[model samples]
Target: MSFFSRMPLFVLLIGVAGLAMLVPAAYAAATAWYEIARSFLFSSVLMLVLTALLGAATAGGRRPGPHGRSVLATMLGVLGVLPIALGLPLAMVLPDTGIFNAWWEMVSCLTTTGASLYAADMLAPPIHLWRALVGWLGGLFILVSAVAVLSPMKVGGFEILSSPYGRSERFRPLPESADPRNQPQFFLGLGADRTTPSARAMRVLRDVGPYYAGLTLALWVILLLAGDPGLVALCRALGTLSTSGISPVAGSVGVHSGVLGEVVVAFFMIFALTRRFWPGGGELRATETLRTDPELRLGLTVVVLVALVLFLRHFFTSFEQEIAASNVATGVLISLRNAAVAAWGGFFNALSFLTTTGWNSVDWQGARSWSGLESPGLLLAGLAIMGGGVATTAGGVKLLRVYALARQSERELERVVHPTSVSGGGRMARRLRSEGAYLAFIFFMLFALSIAVTVLLVSIRPIEFDTAVILSVSALTNTGPLAGTIHLTPSFESTAGFASNPWEGWSGLAALPKTVLAGAMIVGRLETLAILALVTPDFWRR
Candidate 1:
């Protein structure tokens, strides 16, 4: 602990990331991926040596501070440096690839962005697992940072949500005689009067880290039992937990897991949609439990409502277009079946997008598939816009803030209806409803501005306007697969009632345009608010 705590903060984190990569490296060795194993092993050694050098140099240097700026800087440093280190192996393996492209691939994985520069078939199983593993670890890092570092700073998603609570999670006290800057709270970011920064971080890791690993392991085992291949099952478990929605195989999970497999993935994806499932850092309250959880309620409601609407719409349309059916009974039965499939498709896809996992349903055969009509792409996009819970692995604008906004609007409507009607739930509740809504709205607008800016920038490189828009949204949502271009322009397929995003396979995009989307992915993961807070004059003043 003393040795690690002496290390420069970024160096310590980089060392940890390097160590984590060894898991995949060992796996590569076992699978006869000698080159891959050598690459990772060498990277890990280099990182550790760097850690030693930094630790010795920083031994007499200033310690980490409580200021959110430092925390943000550390985070940005990790996001930038770790990807390059992780991509070292990839850059060596992939022919004709520059360091920038390889780093982009690692950035996508570590950010849980799930955008692929190479098709699954092009990569070995070990390499695919490495990507999934990177995403899974990234999710864990975000979770720990959210609870330990960012939450105290009242940045990350913490700014828009609850106020910081009293009483820090326990740890050993730093010596009273220690430098003021080396106070325990300086590292943890809160008033935790415990051990050194390394010890405090490890304490949090010890308590919460196992749950993440356990959940992924349990799901991985289940998926394997459910008939997915070993590598695929492992990737699926990691992807679902991370909400990266990455698949080891070229085809979707449905292709490998079947209906039963998709069901399992869906069940597990609920964890990403609500923080109630993950062990809570805050005090346990009734509302935070699954029974009364707002995220769960709204998510389920959206899933059910959207599914029903899609099902009924398809049912009626199918029934009306029953020209091929010779018998009335046959026509009715086919319509019923089609509606059932459509409903499930709608439900599965909606929840997936809402959680920002971005998994397409097995039945998403597009507009020209088994049924002549298209599955609704715009509806899926809207759900993606709504996002998942604030603290969870999922990304987007978040449902909690959306619910707050909706409640605020409803309260306003009620006041209009009866001018003297008192709002319920006390003053705190009222404030949360109104102030929370305003912040959420600001975040949304900022998000919109970011999208506009990103699209404009990308379009300057000769990218189509609509493609820029979709790609920007997809990147901002941390739903990389969503950025896969959907055909919107007039074409033969459009004339024949079919559309697909040719850019879905990201490798085909021009290097300059790809860079634009990659930048968006980084900004999205850090989020609109964090970026603003990091750069704000007021924040710096503090």
Candidate 2:
């Protein structure tokens, strides 16, 4: 079959790619960054013209229908084209960055992975705005794709998003008629009368689009109220809830360091990590859905346990030291309050970062000093590795797959002790089989491989193993902050190097290492499975 015959999604992707450029172009004009503005305008025009031509060429062609391959093709095409298109302007406008580095930066932003190669302080206002806008748009694409494409395929840990009524078996939409929609309608087609998969996907998009936009708007307003600059607030609102972590300012959340701001971010980060908030008209109870999900349960438990451990450690060591360091009794009281605030900050910080939102407003060094919090940063790193729910914006090993693997292991252990027992009869066992553990195993293995590759890539740099692990986790999980020392700046230019001069010329990192790190960030954000699935022929075959 012709490539376009098998995959018409390229047309849709071309349109999206064209649309993506307008944001940066607008930002350039608004910020009076003429050089950047010109570059963006030129790039946007080129892309729009080219894509429009291609879209026209591909029009008036009809295929049987879209399959998993078409969906994967669309996703892959968008992922590949978007970065290059956006990067063109950056390479042209930025003082001294190669196309490769620019592409990396653009990919990281678009993937909602906050990894950056550019120093925030060094970037012009237009460029920074461009990055945040791309990140936000990237997040929206992922959210829409998750529900419209990935969920139906039962890939990307989207099993929970599967139709609760088991309408996915034949890959058909739920019947429209309340009475006529019967099980036979599911098994056999309605005698050559049926809605196409593409049609259903479009319907789902139409239904969910408003909810997505509303949530984004709500987040933007909240961030604005938190005293963020207008542009920065919009960026944060989009970045935080999308778990993208891209920021316009140098230090991100740490730049402001307000308690209320951090709290707001923490709440949104939590919201993003969950699948329950996605709007659809249903009797489905959101809280109950979350409660019943093993992954959610495990993720929440891990967060709580880690928070308690860190809190106790901070209260004893850091809090005591801060109190002693103070001269006045009032100073001691102030120190205690600081410690309390910092402890709360650290807890929420870990939670948010683990969920891969990476919003940090608290002073890490001061928190450690005031609360005796030794390496609560490491704890956050660990949580990021653990990750949040499956199919979430958060990256990492994904809690559901981990939970499934753990449960399978436990069941096997029990069966080994009692071979004759009804080991497979349990409700959980039935659920696992129906959900397909083989796929989860494959996902876990792929996740591990990605991490290994990322670690190897980072190891080529001057970073140590522990630091490499942290960086890998941060990038792969889309969780920012390296070693709890590095805050949001996206790239090593701001986060790495000496404390005295963070942006002092990428002093420690060589070109190759920077390149590899950037690549890892892109891979992590798009995710191992999504990319791999695109390449797999099996996904294309009926």
Q: Note the Cα lDDT for every prediction shown.
A: 0.72, 0.62
Worst 10 residues of 1 by lDDT: 491-500
- Give one digit per residue, the lDDT tens place, for model 1 in 248-275: 7765567866878888889988887676
TM-score of 1: 0.88
Task: Give candidate 2's TM-score.
Answer: 0.80
Whole-model lDDT, model 1:
0.72
Q: How many steric overlaps are in each model, in order?
A: 6, 6
What would the TM-scores of all predictions be? Answer: 0.88, 0.80
In terms of lDDT, the best-performing candidate is 1
Clashing residue pairs in candidate 2 are 116-490, 116-491, 317-372, 318-371, 318-372, 319-371
User: Whose TM-score is greatest here?
Assistant: 1
